[model samples]
Target chain A: MSLVFAGACSHAPGITGRSERADPKLREEFYRNLGRIRECLEAARPDALIVVAAEHFANFFMDNMPAYCMGMSDEYEGPIEDEEWLAIKRRKIPGNPDLSKRIICDVMQKIDLAYAEEWKFDHGIMVPLHFLTPRYDLPVVPVNINCQGPPLSPLHRAYELGRTLRAACDAQPERIALLGTGGMSHWPCTPDSGKINVPWDKAFLDSFIHNRREDLISYTDEEIFADAGQGGFEIRTFLTVAGATEGSTGELLFYAPIPVYAVGCTVATMAVE
Target chain B: MSLYCIQKLLYQLNRDPYTRQRYHDNFESLLEEYELTKEELGAIREGDIGLLYVMGVNGQILMHYSALIGQEWDEYIHAMKEGVKSHGPVRAGIYTLLKGSES
Candidate 1:
């Protein structure tokens, strides 16, 4: 099986940007779990990592948002925000256009896909990379679901995307790992930025960790916004992972609501047989 | 939609260093490109984070702009709250004031 690993983690910029502001104990625990992800990801020894992220306005915007996009550049650079502000230095990351094209072509057979030869790394990507591949050594295939804009892609489509991605990864000779990174339930950038719906998040994670397709994709946007805040829409990332790892249950490596980080941060991996 | 234009301006400013430079060096010229409302123009000109927040700028874009303008994290959050108080709840967009979160 070329699909060696599949996991998800939170990619809140505050996880790195406002690091010191969060409670030390909670913050360390979160970091430690992220480190655990790094360990597991390294143990898989993937040739390329596909990060299915719900990016902010950093790249795709309302002007022309794509429901799904994959990076197709041989090289990309990022932390598009001020390096000092994001607390991650801007550096070029390697990409494998050949691998991307093969995956994109396969996904296109089952899904309408958008390919970008040019992609800049925003916190949605950089934050995860900072922990999972701190050296920037692995060739990355970046995927984004427009979680920021309204009228998002349907939940079923997101799940289908995971299934499609799995087929594509299985076709490849290189060992591939998938990491879906996003927030749980927290109000970021609003006045209620620190508010977190712990119960709602735990419920969602329960559905996700168990790979319960119906429960994972059953959430209505209105309900997510009302209960989990708009940020909760990012569950699409987790949903995608669930879609890819269907029939295989998952393990929750870590989960906590660190208010300053503006997310019920999560780290977990789905078993891939 | 003037809000779209307003957001477009901030989006360009936040994403592109060239646009950021143009905004810093010849803001009027750069501002001319976007069809903004007088209030939006005034808000941008004054770096009124509160007013901009109240006008319904997406927090993701606005957050980077806040950092660009050198507002600390707490100050940025405060500005959004202050915006709710001064200009009323967010005029539009998905980022509502979260009921009683209005400070």
Candidate 2:
């Protein structure tokens, strides 16, 4: 078996984990999208999944944040957003340490990338993982991109990182799937956190799934930030996945502007030809 | 003055239990370690959402601090809305409401 699946997921626990009594429509649609990803994973039957996501100060802080890092731990700690209300909460998520270590060594040797032996899974990884592999049965290799502050990696560089990840995965024998999770524009921690840029999000989705716009991959961090807010930089996740599956076109499995989540929730699976 | 410093402190508190304990043990002294103005320190110690919102703490970091202090989700969110009324437009950062009333 080889690398069979690649996709991107939006992880805003506020929306995905909202109370049942809250906007029923948004919550229902959110899960429906999650279900779509789950179905794809089941169909692919990947032995291990590689999750590329940004850390929300869970594992590292401004003092020392790596540009890109892979977790080589046997098990990752928590959903980090440990508040009782947010629906997505798990004490620990299993990790494919063997494969994770393999990718780390591969990346370090091949791409000269740095890595950490331990990393806690925050909402970025856990939220999507909860939806993708709910039972925690499937092992995960978590990769974190620095989307927290400035000195961020360039968009194209993120894409290149994805390509490197693809190579690392291909070197392994287990059937592996790649998933990038974060952002469709809902700025968190800003006054506009309550807002969602529907048109911006649509354009991004259209470019990825329908139009196949090459230029979409080149959009700079400033460009994305100007259009979707700083949080939109999380789209770097999508860029990496797209870069890894360069020739493949994606199918939009889910799209909904969930205001409560303060994010334009979207998910898609790519079929590399 | 330094939103970064404010966030750094809060971020540490959010992630590290020991940091939280130290902060709880000596709020004033611990806060002094950061380069914060009186207004910012007061807002943080008092848990003044309005003042902190006006002071321009990022919501991602601020929301977790609110939770640590036992504020409900809706209340934490609303405090931000009320922050605009009580303190004024966001003082700085990405959330800073720009001119022309554009949020």
Candidate 3:
């Protein structure tokens, strides 16, 4: 069975982009947390990691779109602007094709869902990849949720999907870990752009790593969206992690409010005993 | 009220420069559309950037208001810092902040 590590993630714009300049303090904090994640990855040493996250208009468009999509390919790209970084391409971490096929078949049979054979990794996936595995050698099977568009999946449904994904990962003997990335809170644009939800962000982080799955499952999308601001809906990605964990405990590592970008960025790791 | 509505309003403000002036000229109408109270309108008009920050309005909305009132980029950034500082940190995505704040 795969061990799942899930928590709130912040996809700060500059951090995800090719910019070399960074807040020295923040950069140190990010590397420190990445070190911890690297340790966890080494200990688990899973054959594949089923990563759940959102897509940033890179794959799907305003036209034909799926509420949920999975990357079934053998390799994918990281977010880098320079042709050099792009040229030093990384292969899609191999996915358990048999397991992925089964999960897709089961999800389609059981629910009104859709799947995709190809998906390009966006900042949502890339930023974390840079931190989780800077060397870009780790293989990951990616699953993306469309949290931005209308008819978005509700919190409960997202959680349930995670649970289903967990079952699928477990069906295979290959070890796996799950990573969910996104936000704590921020409005995304306006004079008040860099606002962070100190109280709410902390509370969500607490509940997430502590295996408070019920609390997360019961949370309404409206309530989260209201408290966490517009970017808050990304919580659904965490729910996916919670499901994969099968309600296991997680450890909160870092929480920093990046004022420049208006996001309360956090990094956490969850594992099963 | 809803974050979606707030986001939609901000999106409109960022996309259209004249909307800011329209907001200033017909602040009452904007309030009616958003169903904001007098205090809310006053809060935004008086540059209560902190209160505005907590209200979850985005940069595009502020830019629209600033442009409508003929405020320059420097002035807009100043007001934004003041407002954002009032509340600690704003939660908007970094990309939006950079794009909206850039001259």
Candidate 4:
């Protein structure tokens, strides 16, 4: 099997255990969920991982923000912007530039989508990765989806992008695991910013767990942002991941509306059959 | 004025050490670069979050500014709430408190 595994999780700074010391129960549950996902990754044993995550202006800003960008460098630098907050030791994650270049070439030739290279890993990629590849040994291809600022790509478009990613992975020789990271729902920095929509978050987790693709794709970006909160835009990453695992089933390993981090945290894995 | 202008500056301030150094060296000179009103400048100078909120600054921008000034996360959230009461309704941006007026 080319695409051996698929998983998604939220990446908040608080999850780093640096600043927001989450309650014992919350921390335990979060760690347990993370451990469970790590177990799956270990079992899948993919040669390389293609990680899709949202960027918080860590690499790109308004001056030059790409709707989607891929890293094709041999060595990808980790997060440096929020070292104290994220608590991730500064280092370079091993990169699989050849695989990244292969996917880039495939997308550019097949779908006419051009992606920039040389981007670094932000907290979005590094935080979840700390659990997935604690040794920092897995070769990674980082793809950044812009969900931070306005003028976001449509949810359908993100799903389409995920499909494109699947096609690229299928074309490759090595086994690959796709990890889409970010959001269940929690607006960051807004007035009612930290407020969690438990019902909405639960509905999202249920949809993923049951593989309700139609229901998940039905909600437009506007609806998500309005009801779920602005940062809910990050859920677009999950939609993209779901697109990759078409016709596959998934299970929600864990989900919690963690107020400490102001994110409706969740972890789910999909079959890559 | 423009929430974009407010946010852009804050974004830069949060990320750019050089700009942050510039801000610390001379707040007015840095303020002059952006199209901010006197009220906005005053709020920024005094770290007057309530005025900034009332003047239509976005929460995304306001939160970082609060942190830069050393306001704890809870205090930062409370400041925005207090801003609504002390300064009146939110004038603009997405966080413009409508009914609850607390956000």
lDDT (0-100) at residue B21 of candidate 3?
68
Segments of candidate 3 deviating more than 4 angstroms: A4-8, A18-22, A80-99, A109-111, A189-191, B1-103
Write candidate 2's Cα lDDT for A158-198 as tens digits: 87887788887788999999998888677786556658888
lDDT of 4 by residue, A1-273 (tens): 478889999887768843346777887888889999999998999999889998787677666677878888788877744566567887888888888898998866644454655666777898988989999998998887888766777777788788888998998999899999988778776567568899998888777666677887788666776678777888878988888887777888888878878787788899888
Q: Which residue pairs of candidate 2 clash? A: A189-B59, A189-B60
Q: For residue A136, what is the lDDT in candidate 2?
A: 87
DockQ-derived CAPRI band for the predicted complex in model 3: incorrect
lDDT of 1 at B91: 81
Judged by DockQ relative to the true structure, which candidate is superior, 2 or 3?
A: 2
Judge candidate 2 against the unseen true structure and give its global Cα lDDT, from 0 to 1. 0.78
Candidate 3 per-residue lDDT over residues B1-103, each given as its tens digit: 4444544554445433475567657865775676555655666567554455555554434444454455644466676677656766654432233334343
Best by lDDT: 1
- Interface RMSD (Å), every candidate: 2.5, 3.1, 9.1, 3.7
Superposed Cα deviation of residue A135, candidate 1 (Å):
1.0
- Tens-place lDDT digits, model 1, residues B2-91: 888899899999888899999889999999999998999999998899999888898988988888888899999999888889889788
Native-referenced Cα lDDT, model 4 = 0.79
State each model's CA lDDT, in order.
0.91, 0.78, 0.63, 0.79
Query: What is candidate 3's lDDT per residue for A1-273, written digit by digit as tens?
Result: 544344445665545442345487886787688678767776777666667877655566435667787766656655422223222243444445555666677666544556666656756676677667666666677787876654577777787887787767666666767788777676554454567888888888887877687788776655555667657777888887776676478778888777665577787877764
